[model samples]
Target: MTAFQPDLSSALAGSACLGAWAHDPASDRIALSPVLARLLAVPAEAATGTSLTLALAAVEAEDAVRVAGVLRAAGEDGRPFEAEFRTRPGPDGARWLRLMGRCGRDPATGAVTTQGLAFDLTEGRRPVGSDAQQAQRQVNRLADHAAAMKGLVAGLRNPPLARLVDEVAVEVGHELARHLRGGGRQVH
Candidate 1:
């Protein structure tokens, strides 16, 4: 499939925080621009061939499911969607990102696809550490684990094996989230 490279210069007016992405449901593949891959903590080599699950793995645990649901709904219904979510804590700490996209059929193959842009919203904010941040850091480790599993899953040629790995990763992520939520504190 051809890469989706939407004209982003005019849209962002030279903003460094802008990035582009496209998803093809038929192949369950996602293509992320180099800038977006870096922003999402995805390795540059794997960005173009990654899956949606892998892409979402970089999102903060609290926002991953909501973001996935929104994207899935838009893909199924051909509607536009916009979501603002936080990335997992990193060297720069957790940062906010806004994703906007719509579904359309590829003219050549009639395959349904979604293309969009992500804009970093934490440009001016300074990173800080707090109890909540610490807690999120712990949760983000789980996300990192899931991401690693997703990378392995992508390499499996066997459908069953890949599915098993994917399921395990998802279950582990859910369990981690549950354990964190059981703690007496919450982060908004």
Candidate 2:
């Protein structure tokens, strides 16, 4: 299991995030959440059956691919699965949230089951466009860069890619050290 970061407990309690779904291949139903109603870009009472498809459509184009990849990984070889991603909510009063999920087998039918925790990230008081916001965006960008580099390393199997990954590691370490010294979140 991934580290449940410090914010998980509250995110689960407030319903600030969305959820997981157990794929019922037989009943054609998906088990999910109602607060996630807006997330699916639909009404609150709407069932979860359509949320996955709708969510794929509504997620920012850049992130849609990642979400799709994670969704695809869920049913592989019947292994338990998990994924995390963030999407900028639409105009609806929805707030920014982090989604964490777990998928497994259904008890009765042995079909795939999905159960997840939705974490609401609405507690920060940092002003938009403020120093904190800028730092947060920086951290996000660096994280994305790190992920891409890691992916490249996994695919290329060459010394050049390894060197690139090493460079990124050095940069990340330097940034993290600076943050620790300054009392700020690393790269943020």
Candidate 3:
């Protein structure tokens, strides 16, 4: 079983940042949070009972096949699945969504049900014009430079420079993490 991220516990518990769903294939009924309905762009009234066709239609065309495969395998094989895909949530360009769920069967009737949580990854995916994105770009450049330096340092066997480079790399990694965590200001 995939362990739930502790950082998501509060959000999932309150259905704030996360959406949860239970899909019943036998009855063709799906019980989902309002957030899920909103994410799928499905009407609140259409969230349950055979209206999944419309909801699934909201998924990006290229990603729909993978989504269907994961769901189908989960229902038939009782496996857990995780998928990340871009979705056209509105007129705005595509947004990223991460889905994590498990499937199970009724012992008596062999009915398959899949339950899972959804998280909006759009913000992270669309950092295009943000300070964090700029910082990330800088970090990427630093990483590439550091990799080249590592090769030179290894060849020259300069222990002191190698140690300094290692320390700098560690600091760069911390800075990158801070930027990703929304610490918008540059680290030194």
Candidate 4:
């Protein structure tokens, strides 16, 4: 029997609120998935060969320095990193994104690369008010859960099971983000 091969393009297309990215330390270049490119307000075509500075140009001024520092530290230490920052207002208006990833060396090329996922948190954010703080807390919890799930999946030896778990975690995160964005109202 032939092994199952999942169509990554279809999977990525279905995940509108999630994006993946990889950065090469030596070249200071970043490769963003189409969804990530859109979320970051970068053109999809341009994102594939974008420089790290260019990709990060979308980060809001307030968060740019801190995010850059985090990335620099991660690259230096080869550690996992998590950062939440906002993008400048574009056609889609300002968006909040949570990025989680780790730095590692590529065995074949002996180059260091940072890879991770970007989750759109804007939809789940409540407007400024008493509820806003609570909403932020909820968003943080969801991000924490996703990071924890990633760690768990990394430990799993079965590729199919790992992929299934990761997908479920992402779907659940999207549902929760949507619910928070809707002010916690019951759908039905």
Q: Top model by TM-score, which number? A: 2
Ranking by TM-score: 2, 4, 1, 3
Model 1, span 150-183: residue lDDT tens: 7857766778878887887777677566656765
Q: Could you tell me which 10 consecutive residues in candidate 1 have the lowest summed lDDT?
A: 1-10
All candidates in order of lDDT, best leading: 4, 1, 3, 2
Residue pairs whose backbone atoms clash in candidate 2? 22-114
| Residue 107 lDDT (model 1) | 96
Q: What would the TM-scores of all predictions be?
A: 0.58, 0.61, 0.57, 0.60
The 10-residue segment with the lowest total lDDT in model 3: 1-10
Compose the digit string of candidate 4's lDDT tens values, residues 73-149. Answer: 77889989899899998888888888889999989988898888877878667466566667656766777777777
* CA lDDT for candidate 4: 0.77
Look at candidate 1 and tell me the lDDT of residue 5.
61
Q: How would you encode candidate 3's per-residue C-alpha lDDT over 50-120 as one tens digit per residue?
A: 44456677788878778766776777777777887877657645668877898987799877898888877
Quantify all predictions' global Cα lDDT against the true fold. Answer: 0.77, 0.57, 0.72, 0.77
